[model samples]
Target: MDVRTGLFYLFSVVLLFAAFRVITARNPVYAALYLVLTFFRASGIWLLLRAEFPAITLVLVYVGAVMVLFLFVVMMLDIDVDALRAGFWKHFPIAASVGALIALEMAAVLMGGFRASEEPRALPGVAAAAQAGVQFSNTKELGKLLYSEYLYPLEIAAVLLLVAIIAAIALTLRHRKDSKQFDPAQAVRVRASDRLQVIKVAPTRPAAPPAAPDTPAAETK
Candidate 1:
């Protein structure tokens, strides 16, 4: 096989192994790390397909940002693995069925895409740009589609993500009576006079001097 084909098979094999490990690994941190390896392998495959935008985005967004956060969370958490796995056997049958259904659907979609009669066709804009000898960017086309046709759905998704973030923060937030915290509104409304106070009192009278020790002459006398 040629270099590209060999690399594709290598990446695909690693990707599948990493994905399997992600699901089967006993340690959450290891699972997260495996997931990161899976993402990197997927990005490599995307690069091989000449989809630079998606490959870079997959690495930068998922691996760099999301997976790092996930790994940190997994490592930091004090999880009871036994408690978590308590229902594994009970749920295994359903989970296996769902997994099988998903696998079948994906296989059908992929096989349909690989039909010999189906040929790749360029987009209208891309074809026009090609005829005019102008360079057309898939990223620019993606941006146009996101902003125009899918704008509302994109906005809805953004709002949903914002809600999810707020929910996560709220859920993990702890309130401690022992911890000192000031209300921002109260702090903003505070005045100098409220913060500072002066007390006035009558001056204390000086204490009388202590009597001197009896002189030596008095002792002699």
Candidate 2:
């Protein structure tokens, strides 16, 4: 096989293995790590397919940002493996059936003799430039298309993601009575006198002993 085809198969194999491990691994952290590995291999496969923009985006956005966040979250969570596995047998039949169906569907799709109707026609300028072995700027082309044609959808998606991130932070953060939290604005405006108060009080002397006179008068009478 050609080098490209060989590399494709290699990356595909690793991707599949990593994806399998993501589900089957007992440790949640390990599962998250395996998922990150799957993303990395998938990105590599995309790179091989000449989809450099998507490949780099996949690595930067998913592998770098999302997966790292997932890893941190998974690591922070106190997952009890035994508790999680308690209902494994109970759910096994349904889960197994679903898994089997998915596997069968994938197998059918891959094995089915589905051929492309036609080789993809490159853009008017793209084909000529490609033939000259000149590197085409996929990122630039994608940016143009996205901003020009899909700007509204892209902006909406960005706003949605921003809302989701804020929601996630709000949900994860809690007000704890024991934990000390300070508002930055309040802190910045605070005066030294407001923060510290010193009071001077005159010290009181102890009451003098007065009981000795009563016994002396009784003895004289």
Candidate 3:
């Protein structure tokens, strides 16, 4: 077998194993680590496919940023493994049946195209340009395509992701009674005189000592 095919098979096997471990691992942290491994393998496969930009993005964005955050969150959470496993058997049959159904459906869909002879043709502009010696400068092409064709959808997706991030932060962050939180707007509006206050009080003189108690002879007299 060729080197590329050998590498592809190796990566595929590792990807599958890591994906399975992600679900089956008892420890949440281990599962997260396995997921990171899966991402790495997938990125490797993408690199082999000559999708360099997406491959690098997969590593930098998913493996570097998302998976690291996932690892941290998983480590922080106090997962109850026993509780998670308690209903495994009870749910196994239904889960298995659903999984089987999905597998069958996917198989049917994938196999459906096997008998088809014709493939869809690329657009004339794209095909003609590709046929010519014109090679796209990666970043420029990506920027042009993103801004021209997919701009609205990309912006909307970005805004949605930003909203989701804000929601997650709000949900996970708790306000403590001892924590001091300052609002910039409120601070900016405060006056120096309002922040400082002083009061003067007069001092009182000490009272004279009480007279000595009378003796018993003085009381008899």
In candidate 1, stretches whose alpha carbon ends up further than 4 angstroms from where it belongs are 128-136, 143-178, 182-221
What are the RMSDs of all candidates, in order? 8.8, 7.7, 8.5
Candidate 3, which ten residues in sequence have the lowest lDDT sum?
A: 133-142
lDDT of 2 at 12: 96
lDDT of 3 by residue, 1-221 (tens): 99999999999999999999998998988998999999999989987765678888989999999989988887888878999899999999999999999999999988855657857565555577688967634545677889999999999999999999999988656577777767768899999988998778788889999999999999999
Best by lDDT: 1
Native-to-model Cα distance after best TM-score fit, residue 136 in candidate 2, in Å: 3.1
**What TM-score, computed on C-alpha atoms, does each candidate reach?**
0.64, 0.67, 0.65
What is the lDDT, from 0 to 100, of the residue 66 in candidate 3? 94
**Residue-by-residue lDDT tens digits, candidate 2, 110-149:** 6644557546668865887789988887778889999999
lDDT of 1 by residue, 1-221 (tens): 99999999999999999999988998888999999999999999998986778999999999999999988887788999989989999999999999999999999989977889999777898899999999877778889999999999999999999999999987656567777767779999999999999999899999999999999999998
lDDT of 2: 0.88
Candidate ranking (lDDT, best to worst): 1, 2, 3
Question: What lDDT does candidate 2 reach at residue 15?
Answer: 95
